[model samples]
Target chain A: MTIPDTVEAREAVDLLDRTRALVQPELRGACDTLPGPMRRVAMYHFGWEEADGTPAAGAGGKAVRPALVLAACQALGGDPDRAVRAAAAVELAHNFTLLHDDVIDEDVTRRHRPTAWTVFGTADAVLAGDAMLALAVRLLAEDPWPRSAEASARLSDCVIELCAGQQIDCAFEERPPEEVTPEECIGMATAKTGALLGASCAIGALYAGAGEREVRAMDAFGREAGLAFQFIDDLIGIWGDPERTGKPAGADLAARKKSLPVVAALASGTRAGAELAELYRGPMGAAAVARAADAVERAGGRDWAQSQAAERMSKAVGELARAVPDLGAAGGLLSLAEFVTRRNR
Target chain B: MTIPDTVEAREAVDLLDRTRALVQPELRGACDTLPGPMRRVAMYHFGWEEADGTPAAGAGGKAVRPALVLAACQALGGDPDRAVRAAAAVELAHNFTLLHDDVIDEDVTRRHRPTAWTVFGTADAVLAGDAMLALAVRLLAEDPWPRSAEASARLSDCVIELCAGQQIDCAFEERPPEEVTPEECIGMATAKTGALLGASCAIGALYAGAGEREVRAMDAFGREAGLAFQFIDDLIGIWGDPERTGKPAGADLAARKKSLPVVAALASGTRAGAELAELYRGPMGAAAVARAADAVERAGGRDWAQSQAAERMSKAVGELARAVPDLGAAGGLLSLAEFVTRRNR
Candidate 1:
């Protein structure tokens, strides 16, 4: 669990770990308000408890969004303490989507454990996700800050977009791969992955009492970084080690997921791209998954995804620079953005 | 539809219809913010449009909760104009629950029309419901009024309870009728049905700038009335004319729903109760449904539910009296409560 000795790694790990530690108690406290049965489902989903209500060490999410919230607040020369509630709210909202998405996608496992639906049931998982969303809005509204209304509105709007993204993603499953455009896929990814991250940064900046322009700049910064994060995540879905990613090898390809890299490769129209399309049209086995990964690489999907990540990293950093002119106090934000794109897993 | 010439009925219908008219535009405005597909699903669910793009004169819900909101606001000596947003927000939240409940219950019809899931599919229905909920919270938060945070928090908390209620309701379906206690059924009904109604009145009171005691009394009033509403609804579900109810005859009994009256009958411990329990242990046909209805009545379940509704009605009136001592301008709320318990269907 020790972070590397590099300055950027140390800073990124410190900020992320610190934010997770700070937000864990708040998240657990929020779950306390759920009904008895639902509380168990939510607690298990958050990796705070086992299905039997026994305490267990668990690998929760990386708490990346929360780190961005607090780091944005601090980078804006504001008291990060004032934005703790906002950070927790963002994390709660993020987990809400995760729980429901698991149900919608019918995925049985998450974070190296059975998903909440498997542990409890579909009804319980759905309700737990719903309660988590309500709790997120409640947390923001309960904060007596002057701009609580604005923050809540922003969070709700982001949630609406997230729902829209998920709807389109589900709809794409009904369409032929050729019928799914790259522009549509990218828009869905932005709405699904980028919106919440953008809202997190914007909420933090709002709590920091930043001007509108600054808050928007922070939102843009987070949106770009979130896209980079998703691009890298899509790559990891196709190529990362199963042990590190906590999923099967080439899980996205096995499922024929219309991820960015796969879509780009399909759109490339190369010989490998055509072969990959033919393979995707059939049921996938171990060999098919392996061949699919090779074809994606041969069609330049991996390179395209990698370069786009780098491009998005620069765009994100530029946004952060625009928002915070000094850049001296932005080490955490800048390192976090770099870590998002460059992390192997 | 034309209301009766009676003074009480006229006033009640006027207020309810007026509130619906006022809230309709705001609801449409809110849906405009949703994405295209989701917006269409939501609009269809709300009876604003048919499956195609053509407009349809569909029958939406009765807008009972919105009526309570506006009535409470006016009875509290506040300008109802200031509380229009709160009324619309409550209606939005109520419909959000309905859309999800239909999906969860797998009900194919609502308001004499096809349920959203049957038309658009379950995923779209669920996402549309999620969008509706987010829109509810957004409506409250977008209000510049000082109590927007309080109203939003109340709505969210009520939604949490509603989810808990639904979770228990689904769980009850897995249990035998004899195993489902009347008390448990009542608690679930309160959480599912009473909480939002209570929140509705409390929201109105908050927007009215009422004192803490007044707000609490208003909430109590709505909770009592909401229980009575459910009790009456359970009765109608079992025995109401199918044409009026827009459902099959003896729908609840045929579905083996553990409604209040049926649960009360099972808990009666009379000879007819035992016979009814025996009948309920097997699958229900038309003859069985008819026999079960007779058995329920003979076991005093029908009487018990009726008397309980009356008791709750008085309690609601008492709470309203406590909140508004004059009871002069409170005729609208009192009449609405009377109509809830007295309606045949």
Candidate 2:
């Protein structure tokens, strides 16, 4: 079916689910090379098996990153199967970051389940993440594809940026809200969230023998989409349903997280923004959490973030149109971007 | 002058010192590409800077690993300069492991100074280590050399082994000594310590345009030397002087570390070994530490480790002779093995 100009939310979700099913087997196969214990840790993290190795119908991540890889390749007139390794590699690298990020952030729950660190211990979880990274690189290096070097280099560069972004994010936690600038927050989010997504699309283009210009265009598309995704994510952090996000209601406020929306609200310099900043400075009781959430929305944070996401998504679609020219070929990619930006609303 | 058949300890030390000086510049240059904070952390870890960024003659590590890379290249009739990138790559990867291992092991001191984890916060230290790993891979991948692919692959594989070894090491800490086999200890040591050394020599040989046989032989040579290095390191953990080693006396015993010698002692099935096991089961006071040390030595753990190291050194020298086909070219490698096997003593 040729997707329409505007994909419905139901259609986008179905497309993501179908692509995830296609990608999960490749992802699992990549782990087959890992050692026994490390493989178990990865399997558990992917929700392929329970901690004790029992089969469980686990909810893996959205698989949006890998879907982007395949969709970008297809849009560039390449076979999706040829880009499978790139897709799997991007997915592995993404999960590797998540596994380590959880340990570094001391987050206990992901996908409504106990984290890998909690189940396998910190050392094993961290090592598993390391192994996955190596595997990701190996997947690209070991592939017999001609452009493997370029693909690998792009992925490595993206990972370095991811690390830098994460470093800044962790540093931000120590700074007062007044010292944290919106530009800095956006830069960190770009590096942390955008770089990988951009690389995923760029790597797909490289595999499809796309020219440098098209590759760059695809990267720009993914980057803007990634930014939009983060905007919505930050919004959800402040107001997401606990059932949908698998996190506590107002969890970001309770933790006093300086997410993008919260940063924007604090930077607004309005009365509600000042009141929200005050609420953030003190210990967050149930009342304080609810009040902080209300204050953030009242300070124009919610509206600002929603508008920012919409603007970025519009730019992302424009980039995709520029790169592929044939809008029909880009339908899958566009819908995936829509799903990512609108999820958890 | 060509090296003599028997290199005296003074000559060996001079050779190591000279090569280390040559490699340090490349090592520092490699860090130039790191982001500011990460670069600072790396500089401080290498003793190039203080925490506040002031210059210091910090005690960097011995640089033995990089020396092996250059020496192996020269010994195999390749230009040492051609192997400089490989040498720096290996050193960076070694430091990467040290940075993370210190955090995972919760080790407070290294090379007589507070470890990177203690200097930087744990989160930054971990991220810094992650950056270094990416940088290491980038170094190999960016080099336009013909063998860069093989070298990069070797390094990635070695990193996987390192992670596996670390995982096993941490898992061992949770198990009783009796449940941990000597074979497992040796396997862990081989993976944790030997894989990188093997890859170092293999990469050096690769850069030198060596054949498969020569590369494998060089890897085998370094692997044996690495085993010898670990044996001596374990011995030092048990019996080295506090003045030179910069650790508390019998620190390994006090912490009940299942180092090779300790594992060997526990598996000895001798009376002194039994006493050591009994002592290990309880909290270690100063007296208990002293007695544990005595028991390890009396149970033939110390002697067994020494003999094993000597045997491995002999085998390493044999592998070098096989690879180079001229005992004269191998003198540097032989002396390095000797230095590593006898440093603490």
Best by lDDT: 1
Candidate 2, backbone clash total: 0
What TM-score does prediction 1 earn? Answer: 0.96
For model 1, the interface Cα RMSD in angstroms equals 0.7
Candidate 1 lDDT over residue span B252-299, tens digit each: 999888999999999888898898899888989999999999999999
TM-score of chain A of 2: 0.93
Listed in order, the DockQ scores are 0.86, 0.62
lDDT of 1 by residue, A1-345 (tens): 434456787778888889988888888899988998889998899888999999978746888888888998898987888888888889989998898889888989898789999889888988898899999999988998887788899999999999999999999999878567667888998999989888888888888889999999999999999998989999999999887666799999998999998998898889998989999999999999999999999999999999988898789889988889999988888888877665656
**Fraction of native contacts (fnat) of each candidate:** 0.82, 0.51
lDDT (Cα, tens digit) per residue for candidate 2, span A116-164: 9999988888888988888887777677777777888888888878888
- TM, every model: 0.96, 0.92
RMSD of each: 1.9, 3.4
Q: Candidate 1: where is the Cα deviation over 4 Å?
A: A1-5, A241-249, B1-5, B241-249
